[model samples]
Target: MTISNLQEVKSRITVFGQPMICRGCSHEVFIPYELYINVEKPGIGCLYAHDIAICQNCGEARHFSDPSDFDNEKGIFVWALRQYVC
Candidate 1:
């Protein structure tokens, strides 16, 4: 998806791999294995190119997984923000 601004793609994002930081505790989390939510429509190319994100301070749950499954951008962010899972 070609987005002119980062905000356009902000909602279709998720966290993968090592933890960057925590949202609540500000703790740095590390994953020996891939600790992230699976993307809904992660076809072929998108497998390696995950939009995973994590807190850089505390390992709390910021963005969970990719919301590419959803068609609407606003809906994706709404879902993500509601669960705090992402």
Candidate 2:
């Protein structure tokens, strides 16, 4: 999370950042993304999405995926709700 101008407060991350919208309530804002940072070796200072944030109300999830090539390949991070009950 080495975003130069990144500012965060409570559950919502703000200021020109990507909107992490809650699947349950559209008005709710969030930023509980667990990111994997590359700093040991190889391409240093690389940020990859590698965590899961589940919607408490709806019991859905948002998976942050890291592609094969961190630099070349693109990361696919999306908010997908699991709509079902047993």
User: How well does model 2 score by local distance difference test?
Assistant: 0.42
lDDT of 2 by residue, 1-86 (tens): 32222232234432224445666665334334465767667867676545555544454555543222233344643323221121
Query: What local lDDT score does residue 54 receive in model 1, on the 0 to 100 scale?
Result: 43
Worst 10 residues of 1 by lDDT: 1-10
Which candidate number has the best TM-score? Answer: 2
For model 1 the local lDDT of residue 85 reads 23
Give residue 86's error in model 1 in angstroms: 17
lDDT of candidate 1 over 1-86, digit per residue (tens): 11111232112222333334555765544221223444657654333332334443443344434332453755652322111221
Per-model C-alpha lDDT, please? 0.34, 0.42
Question: CA shift at 80, candidate 1, in angstroms?
Answer: 5.2
TM-score each candidate: 0.22, 0.31
